[model samples]
Target: MKPLNDVIAACPPSGIRRFFDIAAEMDDVISLGVGEPDFVTPWRIREAGIFALEHGYTTYTSNAGLPELRRLICEDLEKRYGARYAWDTECLITTGVSEGLDLALRVLLNPGDEVIVPEPCYVAYEPCVSFAGGTPVRVATRWEADFAIDPDAVEAAITPRTKAILIGSPANPTGAVQPRAALEGLVRLAERHDLYLISDEIYDRLTYDDTHVCLGAVPGARERTVVLGGFSKAQAMTGWRVGWICAPQAVAELCVRVHQYTMLCAPHVSQIAAVEALKEAEGDVREMVADYDRRRRVFVKGLREIGLECPEPGGAFYAFPSIRASGLDSETFAERLLHEESVAVVPGDVFGPSGEGHIRCSYATALPQLEEALVRIDRFLGSLR
Candidate 1:
């Protein structure tokens, strides 16, 4: 029989999801593989969704989203990140940051366009680039540099075909926040090359030390950067499927056109919830971030005590540690840890080639779960020696 689209066929199952699937069937498994907040949606936010449903407000919103929600998004962006965008012309609420990423790639890339991605990144960027018929040029960011993007390396990778640079600050898996200097350099490069800058700041609010820096806040960057953010991480609304993209007016208009055909709009009820989330949920986000920060300290210190080389993550809830000293490849180490210790983690190579010999452990679980998982990991490492 004739088969699937070759592009679809070429895409492998997500490395992160596959491990979670296995762990789901195992008894007494402790999974640190999923990159989701452990917190519940704020009661007020959940009630807003429920209230919307009870009021029969389930109909589809305008393709761009509810205007009030868009306005709130604009206000939130400016108030939090020092970035200003026109609510009506510069925002499109998406199904999630995942869809925002998709729309950005679709709207900006043409066949043969090249997108520069930093390795050990969120797993989706390369596949999304490939699906968009663009080449993904991955530049490896070393743990030695705390996974910071090196402007020299990025500039070296660019060619005439290069169309954009995709950045994830408070990056997934690594939890590495790009320093202000690095962001400034990247913005300068984008200007020099006249390339688009897609900054995924989904984990913006999860920072432990420094305040979140929006690339759009840099000089001349507001016009060139497409900022992607959502309710998933900050507000514990992962299942709500609500996110938004803020871009230049022209690019946002184009993205909305594509979004109209692809997802119509983010779910109406979720949009309502998200508006409430932005306004009334700050305390919930603050509390969750504080909890995760404590977990981050405990987890990193525990790993270091076990001889694992873990850099202190600045944001997000993950710890990317080198397991090469255990004399096992990342996949082998992960498999044995799950089977023997019943502690599940994603192999670092799932992010990119540069991530081999490492593993990603999310500290988004409760303290008890994280502490137990660490004990199991220590035992597994000791057994290796």
Candidate 2:
């Protein structure tokens, strides 16, 4: 009858999904396309979910999520990053960081507002901002600068319509962790422009070399920063779809209002599981992070040996290496790599134009599969030459 909303219609489909669907059909494909962790949810966490179900905890949680969870999240943030978030008024549990991002944008943006996003970023960042009735202004981060967004570039992009700055450290597509000085600079920038800073910290616990600085923890940032985090990446709880948002009181209250209408609340059982994750899964998280670090080293070394120029990814389980020497655009590189060698990866260009000559290879898969994928990639590169 009526056409769908124009904004929804205009949003592009996920670039990662194209190769994911192809890999799903192919019998022996080795996929490095998705950013999900391969680890199973810790047994304790899963057991908690089962216990909740057995006790008939199937009802919707409070719109802000379980009180215990919010408290634990706040304590954990303070203990780890020196950030202070009040569990009562400053934190709201969400379906996932995806939902938190959406809710934050909805609460903060009015029609025609602009959000400055640095690329190559998570696939959903730009579209989510747009779907919330904001304009996404993409500022390119250079591979030469290790993909860290420059504060100067961010400052240059701001205009009167600019409303917020969104950033992801230990970023998707490119595993670049922003530096402390850079994050502080961003805080200064936000303060200067009276803009909200949305920091996606899903990979906070997955960093390898440097500690992740919680953006809101930077001096003078608490009032203007919204911190988004989740159990999906670090706790390997992707299917559970549990995450949280921490912001100043007014912003968090508004986000809760939006979330209550749009999401109602995160699943009761999943929230219980997340509580257990925060309580007893610290050892499991450490082991998984150690495993990812090992894989990151091995994968980056393999790519360099195979003639691709890969900067060592500092965090996250991804390695975004330049395939420029192969004389193919990222889309073609990924397409041929999958068809010829059955190795599926996300083409970098789908992230943004700056990603055109690169590809994102996730090392979150097992060691044997990663090794096999490397061999196939090397063979593919040889064939290309």
Candidate 3:
């Protein structure tokens, strides 16, 4: 037998999914582990895909995607964040943010290049960098600071090998949205060091308290930034598998060069559906955001009442709560709660070392499920005591 690729062979499987799989095998398991929105795709967007099929529009689009969709993406970003990019030369339609992340990494990284990734991040960040042949330098973000990236730590981690800074906002697991000032500082760092900024803004529309600062909108960042966005989280279009990458023309050209030889194009039907999402689904997105806000309020308060302290998650649906009170490490806490109380959550350490004492619970579930999950969690904590 031949050997597998060493980098991938050594990479760990997604910790978020391990417990999710376990829960899938059990009945009555209250799973709050996955970050997916519970809402289905808005009717209009789904109908657009159906309409495309009926109208025989299933042919592959140009490697860049449908021009109309790309234009909408550019217009939406400019309207929302003052960022400008050419719809034709600077935007690419990817299968999803996952594929966009891979494409962006492949486009920017060479072997041994480094990407500074802030911790308590989404599970995929580090692995994706590794898969792209880059070293992922993890900078820890503390629970004390609500998991915000410290520019000083990031600056200290920078070396000649460092080529980019990868970040996810309205971040998964922790739900900590990076502050605007910090984003500015990061842009300054990138500008000074001639590094790239890979900003994953998938949850851009799901913020509850703070506005999402677009990294590309930062005065000097856009020229060096790769913005990865999709309709999955807010538009509830996960199954549609459509997303985009917005970057400078040179970077985008290379991305399309690689994409054309690889993915070729995003699914035509999905691209059509995504166009409808960008154009006509704003009201649907607003209603979903409002509903998530309500669920966020209930879930966070419930967690507090149960004595598990959690930082205020400004944007994403997850709540990374400290389970240090349980006298168990995050892995034990999450594992025991799942078996004993039928509540599923992810151990925070899977995100990074700094997440050791916490567990990630998604509030994206229905109100009643969240309430029940909280009750079960409280009882589980009592049992531990």
Model 2, CA-based lDDT: 0.94
Rank the candidate models, highest lDDT first.
2, 1, 3
Looking at model 3, residue 333 earns an lDDT score of: 91
* Candidate 1, 282-302: lDDT as tens digits: 888889999999999999999
| Candidate 2 residue lDDT tens string, 11-85 | 878999989898899989998988888889999999999999999999988999999999999999999999999
Per-residue lDDT, model 3, residue 255, is 92
Q: Per-residue alpha-carbon lDDT of model 3 for 1-385, expressed as tens digits?
A: 9999999999988898889899999999998988888999999999999999999998989999999999999999999889999999999999999999999999999999999999978888999999999999999999898888889999999999999999998788788999998899999999899999999999988898658998999999989999999989999999889999999999999999989999999999999999999889999999999999999989999999999998989988989899998899999999999999999999999999999999999988999999999899999988877
Model 2 misplaced regions, further than 4 Å: none
Question: What TM-score do all the candidates reach, one by one?
Answer: 0.98, 0.99, 0.99
